[model samples]
Target: MAQAVELPDIQFAAEEAAEIQQNIISVYEGLTGRTLQPADPVRLFLSSLAAIIVQQRVLINQTAKSNLLRYASGIQLDHMGLFQGAERLSASAAITTMQFTLSIPLSFPIAVPQGTRIGVQGGDGSIFFVTEEYLEIPAGGTAGAVSAVCSSPGTTGNGFLPGQLNVLMDQLPFIQSVANLTATTGGAEKESDEAFRERIRTAPDSYSTAGPQGAYEYWAKSTSAAILDVHAFSPGNGKVTIVPLLAGGQIPGQNVLDAVAETLEDRGIRPLTDQVTVTAPTSVPYNTNITYYISRSRVSEVPAIQAAVTSAVAAYQLWQKSKLGRDINPSELIARVMTAGALRVVNAAPVYTALTATQVAQEGMTTINYGGLADD
Candidate 1:
């Protein structure tokens, strides 16, 4: 996965208060051809004026920085995003399909009314799903499926995999069972400034009819903030496929896939000639088994060094899985652990594994053992 653009620290207003006051005094002297003493009344007035001018310069610096993408934040960033036609996405409700089945094989048609509720069995009713539309089972069929949305928006309702929501909240005469057929997904909080900024930077790609790879990537990633990375490619003629990796190597569930697909299918965004498909990235699993030693010279700090090494390894695991197609490299793990004060690191698992664009490396088991103190 590509990294975000690195920005350098910059100072828009480099002039200091003293510099402004000195410049004012120099100009005044040049215009009047007279040098005023330190106690002169006119010089005092010029100093005060320079102080105000210094404040104005600070405001000017803020105004200039607000116009830039790198330093802008809050409402300033929102305005920048608006210029690219990218509005920050508000929180959204999770969606799933609830299946209603008859108690027995019914001989007559059964109607599942809209607004029916499905609850998580044996749990509080704080979060639930409501059927978006009515469903009618055929005369002899025992089951019907209807799409549903969460009662509340945001990420709280997400991650409820299929078969988790199995209770019918509302009573239906012949419906014996109700369960979610798809994972609940697409739930997210209001877009963060960083996520919105990334979208704004790439918003130019959306100007076209979604034929370019970057255009497809933009739309797919914009579907949800959980999508940390997107890989768009065309394997054959007229076919474009997108593989998205979620935060922390969490695979995109069926509901997420469907959401992304629908987002890219907008007629105005996707060209008529292009065929778009959204899929989850393949997961390449690996285990973390390692041992590290500490030098005897630093044995007095064993406790602190051990804690740092453990934290370093844990962070390495997250970094390894956070992006799509990130290879499993033992050297990286070793480097991090060593930098954390480990005298030597002996990695036993995950020697090295390369991943394709459509695959992500996942961490399975982790064991960071500390060997006894060794020679310095």
Candidate 2:
């Protein structure tokens, strides 16, 4: 069987003006029984004039074709407000929990006002604002946990550590210091043109009155680009369960879960009878132990090789997590390790118990132990 050739939506290729003028000259010469050379003054003038006229027509045609393609495919659409009539979902900011510790116990509760700025150095230097008006630090308690969100929408808000959030605003001195207990997650960059194009391309076939499985999955992902993976399941009639994982493969926090649920509910796309429950997947941590054989001549490159292998393993883990319920294949991971410019993979043993039905891979949880190279 022959494969079908996929053609571009719009035809933009055009013959050059000079080429068109040459063809016209060839026909004219044949009719007049005269040879027209570039050096001939009359022929040169006519050819130049014809080429310019042809060039203007070509530019007009190309411009019209480009506009038609953009309008038809909707590739040039910008901002979420322009998407999916009446069901627009805006970009979301990353949110995380921050811990505040007081140097000494106060006689009364201390209030950390809402919109208090807490930040880390470098990167986007994004500041996280307290979600509520007043997060109280109880008397005699040295520590308190409060929710905070990024000032703007993007992935730069994620990954702050405990000591990194040292900056605090004036008036919060009673709060002593602030730090993030958990990795700041759920931050995602704005959607790209290609990603939105794919969604629009598939939109027609995915429409359903009762909210088909594909529709649910699509809408769930549309909630946020940071939502790396979404799994929708219906065990029985009128029951829908959604599991969303973050970009780094860990389950999303409560804020993300709530946002997804609210979007689904507000969209009214799901059938009224269906009971939708949005939740995070259980985390399954995996580690690796590998022993590689290195050539005696390149013993000094051990550190570089080890770093490459570790990076490879980390990438593999992310790929595995992107697809929910996929088994962790040891052989595939070993292939990744061997491809890191190593002399030979003498032996590789990945220590991981396969995930259960409701589990997803966790990021920064995998540990790769590189057993010293066995000189060959």
Query: Which regions in candidate 1 have their CA more than 4 angstroms from the true location?
Result: 1-7, 15-63, 295-305
Q: Tally clashes: model 2.
A: 0
lDDT tens per residue, model 2, 235-261:
788999988877667578776887789
- Give model 1 RMSD, 1 decimal: 4.4
RMSD (Å) of each candidate, 1 decimal: 4.4, 7.1
lDDT of 1 by residue, 255-353 (tens): 778878898999977888888888888989899999999999997999999999989988998999888888899999999999999998888998898
Clash counts for the predictions, in order: 0, 0
The candidate maximizing lDDT is 1
Predicted structure with the largest TM-score when compared to the true one: 1
lDDT of each: 0.86, 0.68
Deviation of model 2 at 103, angstroms: 12
Off by over 4 Å in 2: 1-91, 97-114, 119-126, 130-147, 161-183, 193-198, 295-307, 346-348, 351-357, 363-376
Error of 1 at 20 (Å): 9.2
* Model 1 clashes, total count: 0
